[model samples]
Target: MSEQLVEALRGAVGDGHVLTDPDVVEAYAVDWSRRFRGPVLAVVRPADTAEVAAVVSACVTAGVPVLAQGGNTGLVGGSVPGADSAPTVILSTRRLTRLDPVAELAGQVTAGAGVVLADLHRHVRAAGWEYGVDLAARESATVGGTVGTNAGGIRVCCHGMTRAQVVGVEAVLPDGSVISHLGGLPKDNTGYDLTGLLVGSEGTLGVVTAARLRLVRPATGSAVALVGVCDAADALDLVRSSVPRGVRLLAAEIMDAGMLRHVCDVASVPWPLPQQHDHVLLLETESPADGDVAMDLPDDRDVVVALDAADKARFWSYRERAAEATAVLGVPHRFDVSVPMGSWDAFVSDMRARLRGIDEVEEVLVFGHLADGNLHVEVLGPEPEDERADVVVLAAVADHSGSISAEHGVGRAKAAYLALTRSPAEIATMRAIKAALDPHGLFNPGALLPSGPASPSRSS
Candidate 1:
């Protein structure tokens, strides 16, 4: 049966594109975090949307599950097959590299799923524009994958998440049907919002092949301010001060001294501040209004303002590389959760104490987009219980009425604790939608939604 399935995929794509070599499949077997690895029947690289649809159709007919992959850079093990699942075909969109030329006048561009984010940025920048959302993984992350996860980055405070910029999506549904909504219209109140549904579905409902992304004007003038705060409460206060301001806030990032030191040591860049500070609030504002926007924070804190581009980049590099630096130090159990801005300080203090209670939790590093209350916590130890840590923090986040998973989707890592964020009725509704779309459960099995009694559907 596996042989027949491989042949069918090979026919949809090509013999050379269908990879059965264990060495070749190994790279696609595990996710970026290297947490989940599974046996894959084969890896299929489709060149175009037609090939993707054909591949999906063949897999559905063969009764083999399919895991859609783009750049294979997801942190939550979304692209990897589950360990207990049957042998499945890993669908790679690497060859779907077609990208429309940048439309400077329209402020938008349509790009295939395989178009790397960095490449897209370069193309857009050539036309004197920029993609709204940018991530540290832009070098390897694809537009489709970012859209699938509804990725949020430092710029999210200003430009919003990937979902807001996604004007249209082209995807192959679970039943091998191609749904193309590449209109890029500013207004469309038609039927169901299939585009929104698929954006954060994590490939469970459909495979995102391409997206028409909205572009925005690059900042004409920018300024950065690194303020040393005493604690999370002060950081929150600084964030609130930015509100109802004249300048456009580009990013508001908070990092501890430990995070800054680690990134500086890893990058060989000296810390910018003259004195050591426990907590640093990195604030950046950009505007087309005029010269550098005057930023005046409370006089109690030490502040360094960067009017030049070079200095601003230096400060941002530290905040942007927090996760990478932590990874370089050790593979820490990481959590990207968000609470309300009001509860940001309390939640962090509580979660920090809770994490310290565990003997295995060697160290805890906290940082994130403080403008939006999404905190990225990294914990290191001999053997970190990621799931246990997730539960502990998720419960705390719930108590504060916050989200369990912020930018990163549940994937397999947070699937077990999704109940903390969502109500039973909400989960049931999601299960029903899943059953209606993928009745055979052939697409991305064991992701996002937890497995439970099948919801009633038309087929049933």
Candidate 2:
């Protein structure tokens, strides 16, 4: 980076906000993925939307690439910059944390972009309201990042993803212009739903400053159970038999016996898993919204407090610490894939067979939201450079008319296989849209799209 650009940025923001020191720069260079390292010129932490706009305009004029990051907790490498490539400045969103509460005419609370998700949950619950989006990374993940990924969670089947909760958004475009679409439009056939466009664009289209998220009334009662199945086939059958009739299945996460074993060994805690159970299915379902009928529920809310809050959390510790445990085991390649719910069982079987063939693959952990069919597969050790090797699992997932990515965005990690999910026409339209929004390609370049048929391997 040129000294003049640094001086300009220092002039724009105070010396306290602009970090150019090598040690400080290194801290913000990589995201939570730890899959890639970026050589950034500096990381600028702006206080508000105006400051973000000014910094962006400065970077645009300076011909510098600006990589926007929030919480540094994205699974994808969307927040990473190149080390040997042209100077890219990281724009961290941590400093922009703010939550504004509002009540709609229909009576709902909308929050800002920077609010931590778990805090939001507490806030809404205290006020006797609810915002349905829940995820494991609630502590570290920001509301902005969640909205950016349109993040889905354990509650996805009952409510929906982040896209559904967001009624309005206040975003900054690539050109340093603030597009604050805050007013809740009940119905608008006026033009393209720009809010929808920006939601899952992975920061390529724009920066989400704030969002007017939709709210719901709290669930009156809930039931949680660990259903020990004979096998993965039986696990799928339990889902088919139970859900859709009365139970509003909030979550149905599947953990293989190997995963259970790994979790037990890592945490050194006795998991509440059934003996000799091939597959462990942890499910959560809700009772009526009315408090009166909730007590009548087969498993009342106390069951929820006991199982989910205590016993469930004890067992759930294994699931929560899966990422950390796997990191300790060996190098991990996490493939966040999704398919039609109907094909999840078959796809898992096929994937297990393929992975069993690989001598390098020490352990393959399969677990995810079965109702939504978004499976997170972690391959432990041995980096396979072969794209053909990649196709075994990728093709199995694609066989179900599913996506290459469900919650995690298509960053450089999966850019090579992004096309397997979307058609050529769809990808072309996406590229055209990207070119239109970011004419300079200054925002997180070489991500969400492959440079060519073959791309560079990830190195954290």
Which model scores highest in lDDT?
1
What does candidate 1's lDDT look like per residue over 174-253, in tens digits?
Answer: 89999999978888999999999999898899889999989998888777889888777787777677534666888888
Q: Determine which window of 10 residues in candidate 2 has minimal summed lDDT.
A: 294-303
- lDDT of every model, 2 decimals: 0.84, 0.73
Clash numbers, per candidate: 0, 1
Candidate 1, residue 25: the lDDT equals 88
Which window of 10 residues has the lowest lDDT sum in candidate 1?
A: 451-460
TM-score per prediction, in order, is 0.94, 0.90
| lDDT of prediction 1 | 0.84
Candidate 2 lDDT tens digits, 259-371: 77788888887755435566677766666542212122233111222233566566556667766777677556777888776777778778889777777777778887777
